[model samples]
Target chain A: MYDTNYHRASSVEEAVKLRSSQDEARYLSGGMTLIATMKQRLAAPSDLVDLRHVASMKGISVEGRKVRIGAGTTHAEVASSSALKSVCPAICHLAGMIGDPHVRHMGTIGGSVANNDPAADYPSAVLALNATVVTDRREIVADDYFQGMFDTALEEGELITAITFEAPEKAGYAKFPNPASRYALTGVFVAKGASGVRVAVTGAGSNGVFRATDIEIALSASWSSDFVASVAVDAGQLMEDMHATPEYRANLVKVMAKRAVAMAG
Target chain B: MAKVTLTVNGRTMSGECDDRTLLVHFIRDKLGLTGTHVGCDTTQCGACVVHMDGKSVKSCSILAVQAAGSSVTTIEGIASQGELHPVQAAFNQHHGLQCGFCTPGMVMTAVDMINRHGGQLDEVTVRHELEGNICRCTGYHNIVKAVLSANEEMHGASRQAAE
Candidate 1:
């Protein structure tokens, strides 16, 4: 890793100030991905504004059907949260399935969502649940929050404080994890709520995490695993990598969607 | 340069290192506690696992400055009074090591896993939880046996004492 200054920010305001003060500074939350990226020389910021100590940005709270997860809340915290599990067990289960125990101990919901890795697990939940991304400055709805792979609507120096969403009637996530890295080869998250059925696919989309409208429409009509299985995903729109061909990923999309629907039921 | 201070094992230590120095390097080089190994610096191979503030984390992936003020426990810290920790003893008895390259990380990870899951751990759970820590040797058969045995010994003994 390149030499850089590190500053521990205790509050969102201080974190933002620290970030803006440097020409190239990135918010360090969990540092699961950022640190690894830096070690590989993929990212070399002039300074790192560590947000791990930011008090207001670290927790999970659920009241009735409303759920709010602080950006700094670690995956392990989310996975083990009884309050969150009571209302939204699917999200909790998804959290438990990320990278591994050690990585989950340091990876945060905010960092995962902020990074918006196409293969990341959290974006599927965020998008499928239709959560709202609360930043220091504004609240962006999930639809508007995710722009593309490794891209989001977050402005530079803007920090995500929390994510809020209504507990869906039923929600489940299923992923075909890559054997080595455990990243989602093709993952699907399905949710049924007041807004109706929402299906989000991650790890396969060439354009990043995206809504599977055909499956969503089918599930809304029939609400069955068989319906999901019948919905054909276009291989042309998916990504082809060394691990899987786009056609195989397309098939996995349906298989995982079917499994997700079964799990949600 | 960053002056990083943290409590390693039970000892509060301070050191000066580059801001980019990994916690593993700081522990092994700066503090001269070389038990922690760095098998894969990219974070996949869990040869650098350590307990940070009571949770297992990849020390190689964390910067020394980021760990400042936090309490860390490394492989060197587990033994007491020259007596081997139960996990270490279990590994030794169960023949869990071959090259011994991944033992420190395996032991640290096993300690954390046993702490969290307790004596009720099954083979599947132990194997699943061992996902982060990779062992190319031993085929992980005896390592899994060692973790389970240690878990039972630690938590089961505590349960027996309570009863």
Candidate 2:
């Protein structure tokens, strides 16, 4: 069962103060994953600093070619935002397809990225988009942000404030969801950005979200579904689970990459 | 223990709860509102669905203190006086339940969805949106039907009020 002291923060400073002062404290956003983990006795913090009242930590805005999303913005908000739907439909689709409505309504993109479950969908998109995560302390690129499964570059008391992604010329995500948890068995996000073509895969990788450099190279040469499909993905490093084998997840990565590329077109 | 004050339905309720207490537990244990049932300790099940500040949220996934100063609408608060809420009435009328363990959550979820989605209920959409809420009984056919009927009734009432 969950156990913790509760504190609400009216601002980011208050939240940081609570985090710095409290023992074994964890910041609570939508509480979709955090609360569930607590209920299963997986995590037991001494205090929960609720961030709902942190006014600056909500919203989604598109300025020029980049879409900036506040850390505390819910998945529902992301999925339903008209601007995002128009400009970044793939991200919006990923948000809408995550788990179910209640989970989407309660889960925040920042929280999901921070938690970085190997099976999560958002990490792949963030990596594909090459997003920059702005925290209370500093901004970190996606490559620098995610270190390993359930790991990030965030410091002890830092709080993610927003994420900014350069709007891709075209992007799409395809995933084979685990039936039970609705998390991806293997998910791929393919995007053609100003930097170049990028292909990121989640759920299949043993170390969590990683770029499929082979597939990216193929797609960058010619942004086509056929090229993505022809790219060979080595499955030796994937994680094995009850839902699928390492080989199965690795195979799915290529298939999903092809589908995502086709959908992007 | 921490003191939390919030509006339930239209009435304000205040209580002190331990830091570990979930918002669902506070409603069921302290306020004696048992309409919100706990199907699973995990947040995977949407059995403890409630509305917080006009949005549907899983109460099991929130701390009581987190809900301070917010407006919460539990399943118990859906009924007024002795009359059943429209969604509840639709569930009953359409036999949307079997053992009834999942009805309260189903009804509340439907109400929230219909309110937000303009009451344009269809099978695929209802099934898609109701993924969080699980019903082992009735194959969810009657439950979906009930939600659709309630949507019409609710939207019709709104139209009449506008007239």
Q: Which candidate should be chosen as best, given DockQ against the real structure?
A: 1
Give the per-residue lDDT of model 1 (tens digit) for B56-145. 999999999999999999999999999999999999999999999999999999999999885779999999998998888889999999
Report the alpha-carbon TM-score of model 2 versus the true structure: 0.96
**DockQ scores for all the models shown?**
0.92, 0.73
For model 2, the superposed segments whose C-alpha errors exceed 4 Å read B156-163
Please give, for residues A69-141, the per-residue lDDT of candidate 1 as tens digits.
Answer: 9999999999999999888899999999999899999999999999999999999999999999999999999
User: Candidate 1 has what TM-score?
Assistant: 0.99
RMSD for each of the candidates:
0.7, 1.6
After best superposition, candidate 1 residue A130: deviation in angstroms? Answer: 0.4
- What docking tier does model 2 reach? medium
Show pairs that collide, candidate 1. Answer: none
What is residue A32's positional error in candidate 2, in angstroms?
Answer: 1.2
TM-score of chain A of each: 0.99, 0.98
lDDT per residue (tens digit) for residues B1-163 in model 2: 7888999988999999988888999999898889898998677668899998888888888888888889999888888899999999999999999999887788888988998788577788988888889888789999989988898899988989999
